[model samples]
Target: MLLFSPVLSLLALSVVGQQFTNPVLWEDLADTDVIRVNDTYYLTSSTMHYSPGAPILRSYDLVNWEYISHAVPRLDWGSKYDLTGGQRAYVEGIWASTFNYRKSSRTYYWLGCIRGSNTQIYTAPAAEGPWSRKGTISNCYYDAGLLVDPDTDIMYVAYGNTQLSVAQLSSDGLSQARTQNVFNSPSNIGTLEGSRFYKRNGNYYIFVTKPANGQYVLKASSPWGPYTSKQLLFNIQTPIAGGGIPHQGGLVETQNGVWYYMAFVDSYPGGRIPVLAPITWDSDGFPVIQTVNGGWGASYPYPLPKRVLESPVGTDTFNSTSLSHHWEWNHNPEISKFSVGAGLKLETVTVTNDLYVARNTVSRRILGPASTATIVLDYSGMKQGDRAGLALLRDQSAWIGIKNDSGTFRVIMVNGVAMNSNWSTRSTGSEVSATTVTGGKIWLRASADIRPGSGRQGRFSYSTDGKTFTTFGNALVMNNDWHFFMGYRFAVFNYATTSLGGEVIVEEFTLTAA
Candidate 1:
């Protein structure tokens, strides 16, 4: 029988206690978009510059969410563009996407703007697998929104340029049928982006956010006509002033006829976290958002979904033929890098000339806030310049990794400068002899804390067994900017050298909120 120490027992008890305190689901997701299909719910959100553009999450209830798949595998649209060199060009590759379920055809359609260029559309038969890319719609617009009119069988794509325009989508739901400008202000009221169209009882309503102020909802009787500006739904001049810039969200009406507004808040140091509020209709039939004195947080006053299919969290023996959902590449992974039989073996390939280019790596967005992520792997086949580490990355300039050097693993921080911070020495608790530990597994557990003025600080620790953990001593803190361009992500990478073949066998990996 395997014996455990008292400290290990106490740590396990603390983990159990924390779970009871926060039973709600998806406490860490941000930039969220949600859609309900019958009793099941699906969500997608921006993964700016990350390998997977938008993440597809499924939920039985609005509260608890599980990551299912990604909408776009890579952001490689055209040339080898690098957003990592402080260029904010690819901001709209995955920002503010909408998931709409067309009841007529029983198909799921996802629409998103490609920043400065045209709006792109993708469709899937089921929410789970085999999505089709339909290509760009309008070449001149940004920040696009889509809605289907059940009464007319007409699909409308609404987007914000200098003004707002609505275009009819073809029967195939890809190309544009007709285009018309719906609303355009006289003066420069920032950018009239983040628009949503809704038809309620013979009236058409459009809700948009003014980049200058906050957000206001406008009404129109027809899809394209004169729109009347109404009172502001949310007012926050500055984001730090508790003004939530409700960029992109869904106005969902429950089956029981209850209305709710799901949106995201600009909680900077806290990241752009998600918030839910109950919406009520006024005497004039306009939706009113309730703002309490303190601030907005997760509110699931309604009962959560009871019928859920819970997948195994951490039980991959790596005997399959293909990569599991548990495994992700840095950008778009080459098929030759990985193989599975006795165990999951990952080989490091030569970086392409387009290494700094767009959409090179394959990665999944970090799902929950405080989660334990572990992978049992062997790293005896690494040479100088070859590395395998768990990375918390956001482009090439902004990333940190805990890497294995030859036989021993150490915590190393990497920014843009190739030699400035590469392979800096850091301390850790566990140490295995270079020769003794030939091909043993190493596990890392990380926790994220958004401290004031500190931005997002992530602390990582390592353990041989899943029991005893030793802190890595140093923490990585992200620098915050006013633009709100980037968010948080965690990944794994293996870089190969010339002489040594970079191979790692991953036995099992799991992530559950701390």
Candidate 2:
């Protein structure tokens, strides 16, 4: 079904040429690493417990990127990854990935830490992957970076807490070999990790972050070596109101040999968003962000090249036969429970009352500051005791949906606030409202006004006729707690606690930003 879509037009115009400003991507794509191969650029980042773990993004220009695919379909470490045996792996699936491609073997490799499970290596022929797992290495190097030396074809990984080290890997990039201490950051550096390894100009460079001290660069003549480090970005300026402290990302060079450093800042509500800074090399062959007065500024008038890829997050019409790359489940999605044709059909999965623990809840990051998301849900197939809704997912979230009891139905709105910072299922403040419904379909909208000084609040509304929307519940204070460690997202969920076979069909979802 070829529908007339503005999204496709956007993709075309973008490829012709488009410019972007600071904080290029305003979504929670944290712990990012980038690499350029020929005219295309590929990126990998930490999804942390989100299945289809280790998302790989593709870009033509460094500024605009699209979600291409994921390295792992689902983590199979323990019962936690499957949400079975009453176990969960929240904030622990995959973290801080390093992405690389080897021209000699024409293989793409991704190395990421699984926290308690150990570091995993995933490989694929092309970046958009049917990636094969290369088994796990016993080391749990926090925020580890992987590099395959071009000359020697030897793999090396760098990681640590306060004191960092580089360890060698076997030829096949499977197991670890000898280890060597690399750099020992000073105590005052404050929160140092997220290492990304690079080899250039016959020298090995490691880009790592020190939260309070900014981003640092460590250089060594040998992959396994005694290295010297220097501060790359300190007191860097940010263009956005609440954006600064650019740290934790990898570097990429454009087709014209122009280099740029892609990093992230602690942008709350939107989580850690991507930042692009122009980079140049020093006389001693050190990469430095183009800055005035020896410090990188908040923003630059950088001219970006263009690509024809769609933006990473936006509206989904569900008119296609398959789901788009913009969507990802909260965990490994139970694909058997979902189908798509005219609209997205999500069958109910029997689970607890907590939405976080429920399976098959697909989500996309909130494009923030001020944005509104609207979805049309058809609940004609809902059975008694079935709960289906459009949710703004975070520790603190609210949803508006339809609840059916036998032949009777009602539109219900629920607001929940998490108690613990861990973003667990338990919530202390939860409220609900119900109104009699006369039809089998409804349109729900979540409008957020998170502009820096606006106090970051999200409000819920519903429309039975799809034109007039009525505000239903209290404002949800957009939360930025450390435990959730991320931003809110627009999610569609249908679950059953009493029985099975209930389903919800989402016609379309539109996300508009101011």
Q: Candidate 2 — which residues are off by over 4 angstroms?
A: 1-19, 188-191, 292-304, 312-315, 450-454
Q: lDDT for model 2, on a 0 to 1 scale?
A: 0.77
Q: Per-residue CA lDDT of candidate 2, range 429-499, in tens?
A: 35567888877889998887643332678888999999999989777777764456666778888988678
As for candidate 1, its clashing pairs are 329-362, 330-361, 330-362, 331-360, 331-361, 331-362, 332-360, 332-361, 370-514
Show the lowest summed lDDT stretch of 10 residues, model 1: 1-10
TM-score to true structure, per model: 0.78, 0.92
lDDT of 1 by residue, 92-127 (tens): 356666667788898888887766666777778788
Q: Quote the positional error of residue 164 for candidate 1 in Å.
A: 0.6
True-structure Cα RMSD, model 1: 7.2
Clashing residue pairs, backbone N/CA/C < 3 A, model 2: 15-307, 237-298, 238-298
